[model samples]
Target: MSKLLVNEKEIVVPGETLATGMDNLPGNGTYRDGENIIASRLGLVQLEGRAIKLIPLAGRYIPKTGDTIICKVIDVSINGWRLDTNSPYSAMMSLKDATFDFIARGADLTQYYDLGDYAVGKIINVTSQKLVDVTMKGPGLRKLKGGRVVEVASNKVPRIIGKAGSMVSMIKDATGCNITVGQNGLVWIEGTPENEFLAIQTIRKIENESHLSGLTDKIKAYLEKAKKK
Candidate 1:
């Protein structure tokens, strides 16, 4: 008889059996072994009819074209800048794509984006060899000022942002902080010291409990209780 060994939203480890018969289909993060479905990685179970997939619980971000990411300026050159993309591969932003203004030749780029500064940029291209190119010429893409950056598992980002951005929006409303979530797992929060601290705490809570069901309601309750303290 076909039977599922795991429930939806259940946290499962790699190599665990998810189903016992061919009636169940393997999806992403899972594979088929004979008639059984097995998990290929540690993740949360997601069922779509007879197909079973997994949402990764933890992993490093891999750069992809069109992803908006928060990066730090690490090296400023005569024509471009090198940015740390919170991944194994770094990204480059040329002067032509750095800003809307026409910059003069040999101009000091540091005056615009100096070392150690953070910016929100969009990945424009990624080469087969992993060379990444990013652009700052877009709405809400600019240097970040006076904010705290927190790192979480990239896979938990959807839960942190919630369905249609409800989760992060709630944290912003409850704490009065401006929050920007980077698809690369970097989150920037700007507010008063107290509010920023609260936002950080709340985001950490979401990352830790992303595998659990009823997460949205739990986060809402957590924020309400924190406000009372």
Candidate 2:
């Protein structure tokens, strides 16, 4: 006989038994050991039919190819620029990939992307050694100006974005702020200081309560109340 040892959405730690017997299958962040299925990491439990998986609760961003992320320009070189990708590894954006227009050699790269500037970029390559390459020539990829950037748990980004972008769109409509959420966990908010503050507060609330049920309804109610104040 097979049995599920834990309830759905429960927070579990490493080595905990999630289910017993071969009837239950292990999923991501879980492994089968003998007759028992065990949690392989600290995360929230998810039950999809008979497959059990885990949603990470905390961790640093790990860059992957083809991810759209928010990056801060850290160093400008003659041929390219280096960006902090909100991860342990930084990314490189070459001149050829930075823009469609030609950039004259040794022509003061700072004129384009000066240090301390943030931009929306796309990761094009990631090496086995964790070297990352980014590009800024795509649509919606551009420098962000006059706004504050905030960080949250990268794992919770889906919840922050919500289903079909409904959560983020709601916040934008309520606070009247333009918000961009990077898959690497960096968010850029541009608007009046008051509205920006409210947006940040709402995002933090989502990150904190993402594992809870009825999160969408709760967030909608919270935003409505905040707008009244």
Off by over 4 Å in 2: 1-4, 19-25, 32-36
The C-alpha TM-scores of every prediction are: 0.85, 0.89
Worst 10 residues of 2 by lDDT: 99-108
Candidate 2 displacement at residue 196 in angstroms: 1.1
Query: Over the full model, what C-alpha lDDT does candidate 1 score relative to the true structure?
Result: 0.93
lDDT of 1 by residue, 4-63 (tens): 999998989999999998798899999999988999998889999889999887778999
TM-score of 1: 0.85
Question: All candidates' lDDT scores?
Answer: 0.93, 0.93
Clashing pairs in 2: none
Q: Write down the RMSD of all candidates, one decimal each.
A: 2.8, 2.1
